[model samples]
Target: MNIAQSYEKPRWSADLCSCGDTGTCCITCLLPCITFGQIAEVVDEGGSSCVLHGCIYGALMVIQCHCLYSCLYRGKLRAKYRLPSEPCNDYCIHCCCEPCALCQEHAELKNRGLDPSKGWIGPPNAPPPMPPSMIK
Candidate 1:
């Protein structure tokens, strides 16, 4: 499948997403899920523009930018709930595996054309990608 064309919502405008939307990141061995609701909450709470999904997008951009072996690190859920000034190095911003349960549930709900503005039940994943040069 064309990773770029698979999801309805891409990462270009992920920062502006509202709620119930889904996005992918390259931080783990599986696809990590992200939702607009989570984005909004992080933004509203004065958190950094970077979230788990954002980090995935970041890593992909790094690969596109550097054209080398740059790994995607897993983000820290515990630090996310903390103040924006706190250390979020857990998100790795380089390589990661930790997934968020609430975020994934929200994305699934949105995919089904349902609203999950309240909470989430599923977990997020972070799947690795084949290098662009390896693809025919």
Candidate 2:
């Protein structure tokens, strides 16, 4: 069988409102930039800094259409996780419901075993390291 065929189809861990993560929901609702930044940093695997991303998101929110920028990350997250383009396309989804999109992304990472609030989880396949005493 093909390697790709061996894997099951990807699905969102939680529904938009059924997220069950009230804290995240509240945070996203109140301060979307903070939530978006955390989600972006985790999604980017620390390749991008959360503060920088948050600042840019905030700036775009002030100066122009930040949804356009956020939708790009939604696309990136979907691609990275092989998630289905369900409900709607990234652009439409973000434009129509920015807070919901951010919440979903946050829940996606949390369900995938990565906590955005805590930052990147590193490579999935990386080897575990020795304890501090074992290190040189």
Candidate 3:
């Protein structure tokens, strides 16, 4: 199936609040690189390794604004998911509230049935697996 044809209207899963998921909030608060890495891996369709992305994010944090780097993924995610650029533009949102933006993205992935911790959900066009009895 054509990827563009499968696109659904974008919508956020949860509001920007660390309070929504204590574990995610805590982890993100302490080590945003981990969260960002997971999101990047999923967003990139596992084309990049989580460790590599996380390290890059950490390095960016030291020398420059990592939010800028992360915001790029936000755009990719939005495009892939056909989500709207609501509240504000990706750059401004990340620049102003890095953690919240990260959390929101993470939540969005979870809501979409893609667990960032587990990595890519596979090709969006792939057919569902056949039931065991139905398979030859």
Give every collision pair in model 3: 10-83
lDDT, each prediction: 0.34, 0.87, 0.86
Better by TM-score, candidate 3 or 1: 3
lDDT, candidate 1, at 107: 47
Order of all candidates by lDDT, from best down to worst?
2, 3, 1
Candidate 3 C-alpha lDDT tens digits along 21-106: 67878888899999999999999987998899999999999986898899999999999888889789999988888889888899
Better of 2 and 3 by lDDT: 2
Cα-based TM-score, every candidate: 0.22, 0.84, 0.80
Candidate 3, TM-score vs. the true structure? 0.80
Top lDDT model: 2
**lDDT for each residue of candidate 1 in 79-111, tens digit (9 for 90 to 100):** 332313112342332223233323432343345
Residue 98 Cα positional deviation in candidate 3, in Å, after optimal superposition:
0.6
Q: Candidate 1: TM-score? A: 0.22
Ranking by TM-score: 2, 3, 1
